[model samples]
Target: MPRLNAGDATRREAAGHGPDFLEALARGLAVLQAFGPERRQMTLAEAARAVDLPRATVRRALHTLVTLGHLESDGRLFRLTPRVLRLAAGYLGANGLSSILQPRCEQLSAQFGAPCSAAVLDGPEIVFIAYGQPARLLNLTTMVGLRLPAFCTALGRVLLAGLPEAEMEALLQRHPPHAVTAQTELDPLRIRRRIARARSEGFALVDQEAEQGFRSLAVPLRRHDGRVVAALNIGMHSERGTAAALREAVLPTLRAQAADLACQFL
Candidate 1:
């Protein structure tokens, strides 16, 4: 994926509600978010380039974060401190969705001997909030807070199918789909159709599109009022079955779990 740039930041700032927007705070959070698995540490110049902000601006943000104990620097290279995880902890603690879904996901994983997960849509990606996997399955790397492309994963497609047409179109335009594997569908029209099918069918199934050897089936987790708040999915190796067979086997169980969860939502 391309690094977030100054243009993206500028557009976000512009999109923000006028006077109440704190540009400094936004910049600081942006700088913190720029750090990820691929970028664990960076010098001031490297940090600036990653966020595409000026060195001075990024320097101030870095120093502020360091002062707050969220980041640590060893004279030259800066990296996130363990304190940064408190932010994620606060969210996970406040949000009851993960707590409610985790046990059910674990049950599903145990029943099917595969990985089960729950995620919510965020911009062009779906952020995993809860996950469960069989002990023997070591090939899949899913975990809480993992982000995957929204256009490619079964969970993402289910969530995307819940979006309003205009919002979905805008999101598609902003972040055009890219191929993650040879089986990934890159055509926007086809992707939209797949999402539509998910909406109509109340489930989505993908065969080795997001990953080479795994297939997933997903269903939307909706509120009591019918608003989709997240998605639930179970993933297994491609060798387990064909996509149609997988759906026939697991879709009912996935939908039942989703419905059970929905009743708990407001």
Candidate 2:
């Protein structure tokens, strides 16, 4: 069984129902989300344990997903199928944000010789919606749906800076920061100060907090009306440059691209 984090546990407990809520649909989606990089495949019992549900209940959901072509099973372990991607495809196609950001990120990656990405804050995490990498290999690897804690990532810090102070404090209280590395700041007061700095400086630079030997710089993507909706970031190995050098080098380009993209949104 996969270990459930505090965020996952909280979400499960808050899966409340109203007149229009569909419990079956919710359970089916939960089952699909239970599969991750580690828990790629699971037996009926394993799936039930992962979601903290009954074996019989998860069995129905699993088979239902399999029948709908979203999952496949060898009569023992069940795993997601490519058809599940259609769900993400629908949103990407409709929003057109990914389509617009991909080329810009590609250009930025080529220019800086590092990876460039864009992400949006989701609850206590930041979800990468677009990413670009150079031809050469790097230590860090990220995808469109990758989720990282909002407290320790440069991209996340930028997004968090956009939130109202009260809401941000509440969110931090709900999902306290955990150390991703020795350098990660676990103190809530310090975390809040970093976010406040990002708000004042209009950008964030994090060093070896999310992953060892990696550093990232990010700026929020704001709409024409000046409402922040997402964040854009460039990441490179710490050995490549100092944080000051990285910010001085890429901040202009990052802010320029972000401004151009902001024009596209309402």
Candidate 3:
């Protein structure tokens, strides 16, 4: 396939935006994301295919990125440099809430000897920003930057519970449930009822919705201004407790920690 020039790749990314839009910059960043653990290095052809861009365009962009030290190449392969972490660091440093919530998440993990995470709603997914994992050796892949479906997570439920009635209803209407497990709720009426229950109870507990054997309890993390800016959750395997037993045990700790974090946000 023919490769695109850097300018063309940028133009393509900003296809729908106005002429003043920084489409080229957006496309360049998207190209960086094309490399990951599974794809640590790629040739021009692979990079273009991965980001769905023209080969020539990706070639020029890669040349610019390589010169800028964001990407490094040894003739045959191109890989991202540690410089990428600086970009991520800048964002984390600016988000004061995530840092504020970290200690609370640590406290929750300490209390339960389990894993806990604090996240915010981003589109239809919950994106973890701060988390504590006591079993550091465990194979849990959920960490900062991991995004999971909101409808199937307790944190997601807590965030949804805080949404205004109209927006919440619209969200429900948009995503009529599909089952993640036999226990996952699919009916909008039932989902709405669940959200209402969460609002009334001041927390949410979900069992095996995103993945089998995983159970979680969550509460809204409210800011000083009384707006729910994020959610905090404690997670463990279902085998840790029976459905009823988990509710009685973990739910209280989750809510208390959420409240503790909320105070700081205020």
Candidate 4:
């Protein structure tokens, strides 16, 4: 089979995209995603390398993004401008999840005296969309738009548990579980079993998996139609307590809030 270029309309169409699949738009978005908090400023060569696109292709995409005010270039280096934040703002503003969940997450954070977050699965990773914070200084960095591997995070596990078995297996294959810390689970079969258990039990708990000192507990946030659309989680230091203790602390309140929000989706 030939490799399908994500930016090639003919390639995408031949691979199953219809006329409605705008390859140029997809390519442009791909280019935008190449720039993150770390890759703030990048030259054309760096951008090409980051997105695995040809220099010419990246050039066109960069030019298009700059023309649309999503990016700005200073001579040789290109970087995302403040306009990019507007894109995230639009999603948070338009989605009812932010308004409804932010308050609830804030309440949870206050109750637990830690950071609370809501995230949704994005292929092999989970992207935090909403967050709440308490007065305590914490090391968890799951701010909005942050992405972490699905196989290693409590948020990701709960969200993945909501997926169908075939979809979950495919994503796990793509991501391939890794042991981030000594406690991280690396076996794919065991990971699958854990996700299955989370689906049955309606929550997931991971300790020192993605971060060295972090412990996380997550539950699914379902839509009114009973589809799990997101994961809500609380983060604390590993010094806090065991997973069972954390589960006992917040499980009831988390489950209650999730259930209440499920009926209030817009």
Candidate 5:
């Protein structure tokens, strides 16, 4: 059997022993994800390097994706076809989660004239599922399908806290924390302890860890049975106040909305 990639191995271990895991599918998805906003079209070499997969494996996946209409390619470069939007469209267009939470995020964002969003953990990153944009403070960096590293963001931390201990450990091992900014805490032990605290505290506060000049607070968005299905977060300009002040002023509202967000499951 071929050796699985780090991400593939970690995911299988996290789920507790799926011996029959389809490594092919995982590599295909990686190849697809390698084509992002910055990289609209990538050659086979670029795609392989981006995904850290073997060129042969990437070639098969890219060719399969092209044949299926999910990607378009000339002999040299490949880009995602419009049909790829269907994946995000399926999630955002769904009636339950985005429809229910977006208004709350919009109202909360309106209060601070900042951006607010809801996201779910996707392996080592958190993927934005919904966003609330205040007219004056549109953040182009965030939109539906946007993904950011999990160890640095409040939304990612909150979602990470929801995972089982084994799963969390597995994920951390696969995606080691790296400093994005000087303020980022990349120490593995520190991150583990912080995530443990977030689980008990029921929220996560990250200040300039994921991005400079911004602070975020997040709480888990749960289902009726208490499973954390996603996370709700408010991103505010840190120049307005210290993290402590932001906590005092906004944490209450953040927690309230996070708790209320679970009603979508009902």
Candidate 6:
């Protein structure tokens, strides 16, 4: 084989191993993530570079997304539209857990006088799908489509802990770690240990990981086939319960709500 230039090598890699469900999914998600916090609006060149996609490929994808109303452009720059929420809306509409469990979360909140929520893993982050609260004073701040780091959230752990050991190990290897807070775990080995505990115990708890002064308990929402598709959580002040107390008081309610939500998948 003759020596190949960098561009040629990149092209060869980008061409991939041919089409499959995973490749198509990866490309679509790449196109979506090309628009981000800092680069909300981008020109064709910018979006292509941002996603490391060929310019023509990005252009076609952007055009398709625009036609579908998931993206909008002002002749020069493209940005996402509120219509993009419909993509996430489709998932929530199909998953009855988020729709049903939300009201129960409200009941749990009324009974315990705390806020509760449900979340689903979207790539490396967890997206809040539904929430219920007793009072609106505390700033839980998460919205329907808002995303947060999976590694730093109880909701993430509950869903992750439900994964097979090999798959979870692979995911940890792929993610490695980056510190989000003083309490964030940066070591994959340590994270695996915590996930193992969660898997055995059927729930996960976090204190001041995603945000300070907040505590949450989460249980996996399993489908009829016994696969966890999402996580259910209740959030409150860390002072609401000690770790033990959180497991005792909050975990049961979260588990009950998770059970109720699981029926929808069945």
Candidate with top TM-score is 1
Per-model TM-score, in order, reads 0.93, 0.91, 0.79, 0.91, 0.84, 0.80
Q: How many steric overlaps does candidate 5 have?
A: 0
What alpha-carbon RMSD in Å does predicted model 4 have with respect to the real structure? 3.6
Pitting candidate 1 against candidate 2, the one with the higher lDDT is 1
Best by lDDT: 1
lDDT of 5 by residue, 1-266 (tens): 57888897898999886878777898899899777779999999999999998899999999999999999987898998989888878877774777777787789888867788988898999988788878876755658778899988999998999999999999999988988888999889999888998999998999999999889988898887899988988888888888998788778988887667666675
Pairs clashing within candidate 5 = none
Q: On residues 131-173, what C-alpha lDDT tens digit does candidate 6 reach at each position? A: 7777755565546677888877889987788877787777777
Candidate with more favorable, higher lDDT: 2 or 4? 2
Q: Model 1, stretches more than 4 Å misplaced?
A: 1-16, 138-142
Question: What is the C-alpha lDDT profile of model 3 across 1-266, one tens digit per residue?
Answer: 45667886676666766545565687798899888877999999989999998888898889999999999999879999989878767877787877887887877787788888988887677888888878663565648887777887899988988888898888877767777888787777778888888888888889887779988888888876778899988888888887677778887777666666666764
On lDDT, who's better, 1 or 3?
Answer: 1
In candidate 1 the C-alpha lDDT for residue 186 amounts to: 95
TM-score (C-alpha, index-matched) for candidate 1: 0.93
**Cα miss at 230, model 4 (Å)?**
1.4
How well does candidate 3 score on lDDT at residue 210? 76
lDDT of 4 at 56: 93
Check candidate 1 and list the clashing pairs: none
- Residue 61 shift from truth in candidate 4, angstroms: 1.5
